[model samples]
Target: MEKFKSFLKRKDIEISAKRYLIDALGAMAQGLFCSLLIGTIINTFGTQFKIPFLTSPVAVIGGTEYTAGGIASAMSGPAMSIAIGYALKCPPLVLFSLTAAGFAANALGGAGGPLAVLFIAVISAELGKAVSKETRIDILVTPLVTVMAGILLSWLIAPPLGKAAMSVGSLIMWATELQPLLMGILVAVLTGMALTLPISSAAICAALGLTGLAGGAAVAGCCAQMVGFAVMSFKENKWGGLVSQGIGTSMLQMGNIIK
Candidate 1:
């Protein structure tokens, strides 16, 4: 065990919950924001507000036309994979190869693509990192290993993971509909706390494919957590704290909340 730990350390692989769950998960959220979320927002505006250029089809893939936003949204899988690889500090070849793995995971994972990408990307990046620069044929060896591992893993597990996540999300949404008062409070409180933690609540929601009542409750909880902290600390923190915690992030007030 000690020898293995030393090997990992020597290779720059730090095995810790903070590295995988916190740092990588946090980075995953940013990737989602830049790709899926922003694309959806732009598409929404284009559709609702009747913006001409925003709605204009820019490209086509697999016989389907895509607007600017659609192109970005379609790349969510690669974006998430590369983001996680970047967070893990995978080498250049390993990182670039993650795009393929990420695409496979996201495409195969279906609705739960984000979670699949998270799991697969972490494993692939680490595996690639372990083998990185170990051979004279580093360029060829690195990408081959990373891409194969990613695609195989994605094919084997991404769909099942996606289905499982979507099922869980369906259950939650169903339960919320059946018992609005109870489930609403339950989701709100848990999601609110999740928002303040180092974990990525957005990734959680995406993995579960949360929507309707459950989605609304989660959003409400997050907003309340952020705004509530800002309001509570208004006197002590002033506007600076308000903008930081409220608009910026409720995670900023996590230490204060714990205190």
Candidate 2:
């Protein structure tokens, strides 16, 4: 218990921020491969079975493909932001402000609008630090306040932005015929990359119009990535039994190929 507490204490905000940034970039690159993998799997299986999966919930909400990845990516960021804010002893209002800023920045950045998420994240984190007095009560209230603020802000701003992103997606799609092979390659590569990040493969599949096949491929890719990671970990440490054990469990759960 003491060792666990010490480990938790070692998780600094600066380190968290850096890790999140790396994850963001990795997610973007991996999104492309995920799309390709999903596309390929769908193409192969869709021929034999009628799969009824949707690529991402974001696509359902945004009414556009381009925003799918962003939406999926946003799902994890908020929770992480809230946790980080709490850890750093950010005030309730400040935590919410930071969340809002990060949400907006990520939303805008994913849609190719601007490179503002980093700046927003930094400012929000600093502001949170200033306002929070390092109290347990503050940590408890931070997520709630942040969530409310984020919801209000997103409600006001997301609609128009979503529409614009949809328009951009349409333009891109219209410019070329959607090719299955290309999509497959892109999805595979992206999925491989995203495995290291905190992004969703479902969103990438949606972006590529592989909604029906996303779920299956995602499960498979996740399983494959976990296996790969386990192998690598084992190679580094001869006593890495835990990694192999986890891989075995994940494989058992995700091995079934749909169709």
Residue-by-residue lDDT tens digits, candidate 1, 1-259 = 9999889998889988778877777677567656775687789889999998889999878899999899888887898888889989989999999999989998888766777888999999999999999999999999999999999999999988866655544544555665788888868876776666533456567766667888888888888998998899999989987876675566655444434
Q: What is the lDDT of residue 186 in candidate 1?
A: 69
Error of 2 at 58 (Å): 24
User: Candidate 2: which stretches are off by over 4 Å?
Assistant: 1-78, 86-122, 133-183, 206-220, 234-259
Best by lDDT: 1
What local lDDT score does residue 234 receive in model 1, on the 0 to 100 scale? 96
The RMSD (Cα, Å) of candidate 1 is: 5.0
Estimate, for each residue in 1-259, the C-alpha lDDT of model 2 and write its tens digit. Answer: 8875564454333445434444433332233223333344444454446443423332544454523334443343443444444444555566565555555644644442122333344445544443354567876555444445445444455444544444434433432334655544444444544443333333433575634343344455556666755555565444543343233222211212110
Error of 2 at 75 (Å): 8.8
Q: Give the C-alpha miss distance for residue 236 in model 1, angstroms.
A: 13
